[model samples]
Target: MVAGTVSGTAEWSRPRATHAEVTVGFGTDDTTVQVRSVTTTVANRTELTLANALVDTRLQFLTAGEADDLSVAADGRTRTYDRTVTVTVTLYAGDQDTETVAADVPVEIVVTNEPGNSEESGGSNAGAT
Candidate 1:
């Protein structure tokens, strides 16, 4: 993870994606507590903890990458279009006053393209005389 600066204040904002996909997590930290929630501000300050208050989740990103696209058949009456999906993970401290931390987590995004449908020809049954 790289130490950087963030600007904004949000209790629950969308995660940041690196190469199209967005993922959020903490830095090199490990804990046993489970994250309850996360909060952030325009200044890019995140705070998080655990609901149980036992241990910290120590949120952090493992890995991230791009996924494949979905495929669809196109019809003559309708048109085909391309679509994509991005995924990301966020680390939370599980505290109301705490903010959400961001890291480069592993994620996959899918892109799909719709194709046209094919027409069928008229035919008789083989048993028909």
Candidate 2:
């Protein structure tokens, strides 16, 4: 099985819709290899369910007071953080639940602070008075 990488950016002050290129695959191209379930370790961070896209996934950029500390780059203009997200998928054969395959893939999440990217723009208020 294989999974794609995830990269996202947010402002240090506000939240934004998370972004990522998520892809899941199997070793064998079996038509019956359907996905029974999909989950991620960043479910809470992304505020989303791996099940469907019905809900919104807003990201809270690496703020203060968290297990992972924020990294300041370019002299405090940008704050970044790295996180590992595990995407687990359960596959089953068509019309049969007994034959199931489970796979876990760890994807890295790099969230950096972008300048001027707010609701007004994207996530920055630098130009604001």
Candidate 3:
């Protein structure tokens, strides 16, 4: 198992062997993120699974604001949202044979809204013209 950290706006890439590459993307709500493996080792026969605090049993990306909203709801405040995601890769080596690797990745979702600069911070114009 491997452990690491990633940001919401970045992609994490892990290369295995000489021709296998694992890429993970934390896409925005409007973006379609797909987990795929390009490898010559197993002829592209690979399965990817992504599990996190907000997702499970599948590989997918959270929406742009989804993580931030979840963090706020969980703690009544949001600034830097943090979550742990686990990625599992299963490679089919041959008939009835396979190899699996798991990684525990920490993700940091940055809330772009700056305090005192947004209405949510009770700015002077919060309720005024």
TM-score for each of the candidates: 0.18, 0.25, 0.36
lDDT of 2 by residue, 1-129 (tens): 122332232112212322322223322222222222233232213233343431223323223443233333432254333333333322222322221222343333343434444595554544211
Rank the models by lDDT, top first. Answer: 3, 2, 1
Off by over 4 Å in 3: 1-40, 43-60, 64-78, 115-129
Off by over 4 Å in 2: 1-64, 77-80, 91-129
Predicted structure 2, TM vs. truth: 0.25
Q: Write the per-residue lDDT of candidate 3 for residues 1-129, one digit (tens) a residue.
A: 112333232122332322223445443344424443333343442333232221322444454455334432322234564555544344443443245555656566554332234466664321110
From the highest TM-score down, the ranking of the candidates is: 3, 2, 1
Backbone clashes (count) for model 1 = 29
lDDT of each: 0.26, 0.30, 0.38
Superpose all Cα atoms of candidate 3 onto the true structure and report the RMSD in Å to 1 decimal: 11.4
Model 1 Cα lDDT, one tens digit per residue, 77-115: 232322211112243333222222333322222223333
RMSD of each: 16.9, 16.9, 11.4
Q: How far out, in Å, is residue 2 in model 2?
A: 24
